[model samples]
Target chain A: MRLRGIAVVWGVLAVAAAAGLFRLKYEVIALEERLATLTHAIEADRRAIHVLRAEWSYFNDPDSLDKRVGAKLDLVPMDPAHIIALDALPFRPKPVGETAGGPARPPRVLNPGSAAPIPVPGQKPATLAEYTVMRTQP
Target chain B: MMPALLRSLVRRSSRRGAFLYPGAEIRDLPGAQGRHPARVRVSVEGQAKAAVEVGRNRLAITAGVFALAFCVIAGRLVDLMALNGGEAEAMAAAMAASDGPVVGAVVARSDIVDRNGVILATNLPTVNLYADTRAILDPEEAARRLVQLFPDMEYGETRDKLASGGHFVYLRRHLTPEQQEAVNLLGQPGLEFEPTERRVYPQGPLAAHVLGATSTDNHGIAGIESSFDRYLLEKAEPLQLSLDVRVQHAVRDVLLKAVDRFHAIAGAALVADVRTGEILALVSLPDYQPEAFSGAPADSRRNRATLGVYEMGSTFKLVNTALGLEVGGYHVTDGFDASHPLRMAGFTIHDDHAQARWLSIEEILVHSSNIGSAKMALAIGGDAQKAFLDRLGLLSPISLELPEVGKPLYPDPWRPINTVTISYGHGVAVTPVHMVNAVMPLVNGGWYRPATLLRQDPEAPPPGHQVVSARTSDTMRSLMRRVVTDGTGRKADVAGYLVGGKTGTAEKNEHGRYRHKALLPSFVAAFPMDDPRYVVLAMLDEPKGIPETHGFAAAGWNAAPTAGAMIARIAPILGVRPRGPETPVAPEVRFATASGDAGRAVH
Candidate 1:
């Protein structure tokens, strides 16, 4: 009886040991598969980042900017003659305020050495106050 | 068998012994020998047989274990040699081939382009020549032939490289395809060719400051190239910027002509798409050609559009006026007394072109009165002014993708004096990019979008924020138009385009004092003011008054007329049709007045 009991205990231990060993082997295999999947994902992400950075570098190129604008805008190259200087602006005489007669009287040109004056048509004579007021008004 | 033999021998000896020996006892000798001889032999034989069986069994088990272990080891060896041997051999070969010292590797670079799929920058294929000096049979002959092929190569340098006992040495880098072919014809055993990449700029110096140039080894050193180095080095796709090449050429051409006409130290121009916040064209001169970047002077390489910050003169009046209308509740027809200079905090604010009378808000902007702007700023108060400018991105360093950006320079601790000076664009300094970006909201329906360089998906969500009221924006547009049509920016008016803009001429700060003789002339304008689309800006640095300018380097004399020429030349190219002769002028300004205020209805 005692020997039989000892044999049963030893049998249980051997079965348990075999089961544990098989489970350990399967666990190692599962872990390796997970590691491989994760590694692939990481590599893919790195490649994507690389592609985006390359795209950025390409877009900022200077020659490309010039061509697109030229094609889109119907522009011709300009030279110094195209630009006008402030001094070249034609001058205009100041205007005057309205009078009861329906309009202000035009400025008159004084004759040399004489009090008599020659009237200019379609031109209004403006006072200092009126000119200041008009100049300030938008 | 040996035991049986011994037993028989003993028996014979016992039998032969004298049984009758007088000294031998009968019970001790003769009786035992006769009874147990056969039994003793059988027991001895059985024991010997059992020992032999055990020895054989033990030997059999040992042989079985040894055979199993040997087979497993042999199978593993075959698996390794057959399954992975090719890769292992290749690795070994690579190791052997790289036995010489190594210099820097020629790494691949990235491509650059405009937003419209145009190639602005690219890396062309090139070759580098190298030599295995230890393999050279005649160093003198090799050096002489190389020198003859490449006259630029110093003879002494080539000879030293050839004679250096090292196994490998670099002969030349960035060799053209023709040069490589010529070298290959020599057929020197030690000579080898290594492929490399060289950066190429197709646009010459049109956008030199913005694109920047790379070094010989393909490392970016300035502008957007240097700023986005890591992206350029690692990314595979080309970078797409929001610049338009045609606009860049137009703006540059106009500014170049202005520079020659006015003898300006430098010039810059920028055109921005207000709706998308894309910088259509940005030009800075004197600009350097990227192809000859190394030979350019330091000043030529500086990006004035995005790097140099300056006081923008009367241009700041637009911001102040907007703030007054928005925060101070001032209407377009609100009146301000411009008859006298305003004195505050020991400073007198006066307009260079004074208007000595009570002027309406619209008139003040049209005339660009310094005193009027000061009063409006005072009405808005200091806190509101600061907040408005800050919200407009005028109080800090602008956050753009490019590395060559400048920070706004303002007085610390925002004082009243600073506020007054800033109102007239005196105490504050900002880059031209900042000015263009800040003004975008005024014409873009009050939305502020940070500029982008990449091509954006049309389906993607919008990437901007609203910074002003749409009503205020419309009002500002009208005011800008009036300035061009009948006020200070008359020179910027393009016929049939309804052009609108502001003019500025700032005195250069020299030795802590304003230089009266030197002026920085600038103009900012937008076309078809009814529904603003694009904002254009041009500036001339320290432009000298010329004969044509009547000895005046003001914005009207220099920058404004340049903008006009640029718009006229570029308008049709931008797909904007010239207005028909009968097209009515768009009424830009809508005057809001106090109810019952008696005035000739100002439109």
Candidate 2:
């Protein structure tokens, strides 16, 4: 009687294990199908993005921009006379009625950022190259 | 007896085992010593009964074992076929993760970008629509539907194609996805979409000649496209050219307006960096849209700047004076007589507006005296002139990154007449690119760098060949500056940039004779003559006399002013700052300190 009881218990365990394995197998099959579908979706999205990038570049073409901007904007090409080298600028002039070294020491000129202004004749900076480095201080 | 018969039958039967059942029950023969006891009586009925019981037990055992084995096998199959399904899913997910985003497909040709990384030519993914004609059950319906979707398609032609019994046929290529979708909606079983690549020029006709065009199969057929076909097809990286779109547009816009204003047959303009040998802007017109390449006229398709050789007229004067000073042992202070036209080998070489007196070499160039240039070339000797021209790469086709290079036309024997005529840019014909390439060395310290369409790193510029002495180059720059300041190229002068160049107005040679009315006027210029950074050339082919040009079609009136406008527009963009008049020119270009009044002496 005891042996029969042990056999019954072993049979029940075996059946339960088989059922678990069967459930796992179906779940795996379902997951694989989902994976295949997801892979396809990602590939499709990637191709779409590629197409969009090409179109974006096409629409932003310079000629098209000129046409689209039209008469609303009165933009024009730059003029060379408007540009001046930094070294070509005229120096700052002295202030009116002020002595050469009155109090501020002429506002520390090697540094235009701190220099007092009374624009000098033929000394005014013509372009950013001169003005950018005129300020000598930290 | 029955037991024996049964055993024998069982042994003889191929389907049954030879061994008899060990558990046989001796039912009728139990302790049988009765009656005939014949060979242990072979009790048939009892033995038969016992054999039947034994057979039943054996069959039960065999069935049980088979059932157990089948159960194990079924369990293993379930584990592998169904239970391990998750493994496949995991593997697939890992594969997808590993692959990440899709790899970029090999483009039929690499994109061509400008110096600043603006797209000029690119590949766009498109679909080619085709059909399996045999698969089309209702050819007429399918063709009608296709025609409706694509208005460009002819109904009868499409119908005939679809009705054909062939296995396959291409209907249309380079269709947009939206068009593909619309075709798909037609529900034709035979219709199919084949993914393909189509080359696109986003800038339209802006850089047409430089970028060139590809064939229907996407192979490069012209311009830089044809030259760099291998690199374009094999490389993944975009090919960066030296062209600057802003400058290119400026050149084209200015040239187009000038061409239209003059009612000229055609026009060409170029901007090249003096130090780098990089061509920033090259415009040839009337240009055609690169996208609609098949319909362009042959004339419009010509890359005149690089491919059309013409008597570059007086622009060659720059080369003449530079060579005279460099190798002919000529002096800036030397005097050349231009009082009368000189006859050289039965050809009269004279100035158009003769400066009727002895003029300095400086004044000779400013006056554009053919006699003075011829005298100078004669002084240099024919051999020296030929060598100089050869060194300038003007005697042969220039090697450049374009398939459409022009072969220079010059007198083969190079007689004294050829020498004298070539002195004033008559006997020799060269492309505008050749003119600029040669003149660049004169203004940029005697270094001759070959012209290129690809961008070069400024920090690591390619080595240049020495073309002239530095002293001669400086003297040449001063002379050229004098041309703009006081001579024929005065109109090309930009106030702040200190522009300097030479002007040329050649009568167009037509049907083996020069047409006085038709002219090829051109100007070659370099800016900030103190330290030349850029060389610009503008040419007008057969421009008619216009009233606004003071009824003059000379280089000074047309080509010089056009160059001036182009320089004014592109100078600031090219980062060349304007210097005030008070600012001294770099010391090198001022080879001579003498100041002069030659305003009327030049003409």
**Candidate with best lDDT:** 2
Give the TM-score of each candidate: 0.67, 0.74
Stretches of model 1 off by over 4 angstroms after superposition: A1-138, B1-107, B291-295, B344-346, B458-461, B577-603
> In angstroms, how far off is B397's CA in candidate 1?
0.5
Backbone atom clashes (below 3 Å) for every candidate: 30, 17
Residue by residue across B110-153, what tens digits does model 2's lDDT show?
78889988788888878899999878999999988898899999
DockQ of each: 0.03, 0.20
Q: What is the TM-score of chain B alone in each candidate?
A: 0.79, 0.80
Which predicted model would earn the best TM-score?
A: 2
Q: All candidates' lDDT scores?
A: 0.76, 0.84
- lDDT tens per residue, model 2, A38-106: 867876775576556556667877666766666567776677655644434345555778785554553
